[model samples]
Target: MEPRFLLMADVAEQLNVSASQVYHMVRSGELPAIKIGGRGQWRIERSKLEEYIERKYAETAEWVRTNPLVEKDDPDLS
Candidate 1:
């Protein structure tokens, strides 16, 4: 079974982002985390990561709904 909490580096590896990005996310309150140990090591809960992913999906869906497709010369836009 996976640990309930993971090191910041572990979370970064799982998310495929830089460890610094994870730290920034934690600092910015975009991702929930806890600092433990005398050196203030950061740990991210698995559930919080799942919650973050869900929130992103919801945000993206809302954005797509608010901004419908528009005619553009760029084929990628379609």
Candidate 2:
């Protein structure tokens, strides 16, 4: 295997967003990350990224359950 973890730019491309956005996600704790350098070089595992996405959707569902207004106002459901 080349490497299990991916660099910031690679992860951003994989998610189809800017690297700065990815960094923001990491900072916000939306995505799992690891720092490698003194300058705060961050990397994320591919598997962890997938798991993060799943967890995000799951959390959204849970939030809708507890916050019924969101589900009620979501026009896309009907």
Candidate 3:
């Protein structure tokens, strides 16, 4: 079975972003994570990652709803 927790690198790979970005997310409290060991390594729960993705999807949908696309032929472009 897959592990319940994932390393920062793993989360970055899944999200197609850099490891530092994941670290920033963790630091900024945008993503939930736990630090373990004497060295204090960060580990994110798989469920929390899933939740973040779902929340981003919802936010994007809302943004799209509020900001409709503008056509190239629209008079505002001229």
Candidate 4:
């Protein structure tokens, strides 16, 4: 069974991004996380990470809808 919570490094690996990027997301409140232990380690819930991914998918779809692609060689380009 997968762990309920994941380390910052684990989240980074899953997202294919640098650890610092994940840390920044947490710090910026874009991704919810919790700091635990006396040393203050960050842990992100697996469900929350999944939620973030889904949210990004929705946001990307909206962006694509609003920003239609511009094809090259279009008369407008000239």
On lDDT, the leading prediction is 3
For candidate 4, list the clashing residue pairs, or say none.
Answer: none
Q: Model 4 off-target regions past 4 Å?
A: 73-78
Residue range with the least summed lDDT across 10 consecutive positions in model 3: 69-78
- Flag the better candidate by TM-score, 2 or 3: 3
Residue 72 displacement (Å), model 2: 17
Assess each prediction's global lDDT (C-alpha) against the native: 0.93, 0.88, 0.98, 0.97
Q: Which residue pairs come into collision in candidate 2?
A: none
- Cα lDDT tens digits for candidate 2, 17-52: 999999999999888899988898898988888898
Comparing 1 and 4 on lDDT, the stronger one: 4
Cα lDDT for residue 46, candidate 1: 97
Model 3: per-residue Cα lDDT at residue 56: 100
lDDT computed for candidate 4: 0.97
